[model samples]
Target: MTTTDLLNVRSLSFAYERRRIVDLWSERFDAGLVWLRGPNGVGKSTRLKLLAGALAPQYGSATLNGKVDLLTDPLAWRREVAWVSAEPPPFEHLSPAELFGFLAGLYPRADRARWELHIEGFGLAPFLRQPLRQLSTGTQHKAALAAALALGTTVLLLDEPLNALDEASLVHWRACMAQAAASPDRLMLVVSHEELGVTPTRELILKP
Candidate 1:
């Protein structure tokens, strides 16, 4: 690992219904974009959730910046990470604006101005005032992304974020990812089935 490597996972394991999904998983991520590539059942999403501190590991730990470990300092680890799940935000009754407002309060580093910039960049302004339930799946996904992007976290985990974007939105978001990848202090991990539109710094493919 290089000096820039900040995110580390060691001997990680997790299961569901007594069935193993990730077993003996260990990896270290340095600054830049790393695409977690794999087939549908390869547990890419599960790994992201583990790295994001959204799910507890049955054994092992994820540490960030050498100072925060998922098991020993979960809240700090979570604060240093931002995640965009494959699913849309679940607050059906909240408009994008309302959702951002709530999330901003939760993340002390959230930038409202940055969120607005992402909204404009993704062409999501027209749907900002509409409730999430009223938006298309793609639009809702964009809304979720805007919020996450503005969180200013050191590690950004994205699960199939390009799933339902239109051509224009896709282009802008790709640019956004590329820009973020240029940062020397951040690690951006994207889980995707396709790599056509992204210039990943490196890739880790999980075999089923």
Candidate 2:
């Protein structure tokens, strides 16, 4: 396996309060955009959380770069993988500019220049100085997305990425994902309910 074979989940099991969600799930993730599709109650979000190491697996293992464990190697795992959810963590008091500066410190190797480009492309400059709570839902979402895109991680896990964007922004974001996936060293796993016009390298459907 090469760098493209960065994420591997083997015999993974996850349960929520004794209710099994993912059982004995195993798969190898390769570079490129992989659309993770499934019906509403099939644990798509849960699976992404497991893969992102936001939630620990009840059993089995998830490996990053073929060696780093998602459970025991959190810090190392986060450095190479970026997770973006539909509703991002609250930053009500912080402006987009302020929030980006704060989060950028965590990823030392993140591309500041590219981050700026995302901000411009997403048309977030107008609201960049306003508090997040004051911005529209779509603007706030774009701010969060800008941070994730700026991270320059090897693996990107995006949940409902097209949630609140306007038509123009939607087109721009699709281009962004497409451009990022063009790199052979990067892997973008996205969970979307509708087609956003960008073609996925592959699609994996999880049936309940």
Candidate 3:
């Protein structure tokens, strides 16, 4: 395994009540941009959840950094990976800055400058003070993405990152993703139906 290889899976299999999803999979995910594209209900989110340690596989095994089991140490595992979903979770009364600050507290070494930069980059500066419940879907998504990106983890698992964004915001998101992908220590796994705009180093399609 190379230094760039971050995730290693062997004979991985996952199923829901005997209905197989991921089957006999063995793959090495290196530090780079990887796109997982497939039709709806084809297990894209399921595969990502497994990789992110949100779900345990029924069979086989996966190791992060060669030895750590995601299931055994989920919090520690999450420190190495970040998940960004298409549907922004209900933020309710929390302000964007407040929410960001809360997430920042999780990482003592988090870069404040980078966090502010993302806030501004996403055009979320104006709405920072407004309650997240008051923001539009696109703005809410931006805030969520900003918070996740600010965590500065090694792996980013994004599901339909472009959803609900306008054309200009989409452009900005593409640029942001491109910069994240440029880091040799960073690995981005995106699940999307539309063209990702940025060129991915590898593409994997799940079949039903």
- Which parts of model 1 are misplaced by more than 4 Å? 1-4
Candidate 3 Cα outliers beyond 4 Å, as residue runs: 1-4
Candidate 1's displacement at residue 171, Å, is 1.2
Write model 3 residue lDDT over 91-197, tens digit each, in one string: 56898898888777875556678878888788889999999999998898888888878788877888888889888778788887787667677788999998989
Q: After TM-score superposition, what is the CA distance of residue 26 in candidate 3 from its true location, in Å?
A: 2.6
For TM-score, the strongest prediction is 1
lDDT of 3 at 145: 85
> Which predicted model would earn the best lDDT?
1
What clash count does candidate 1 reach? 0
Ranking by lDDT: 1, 2, 3
Ranking by TM-score: 1, 2, 3
lDDT of 1 by residue, 113-182 (tens): 9999999988999998999999999999999999999988999999988899999998889998898678
Q: For model 2, what is the C-alpha lDDT against the true structure? A: 0.84
TM-score of each: 0.95, 0.94, 0.89
Name the 10 consecutive residues with the lowest summed lDDT in model 3: 83-92
Q: Cα lDDT of model 3 overall? A: 0.80
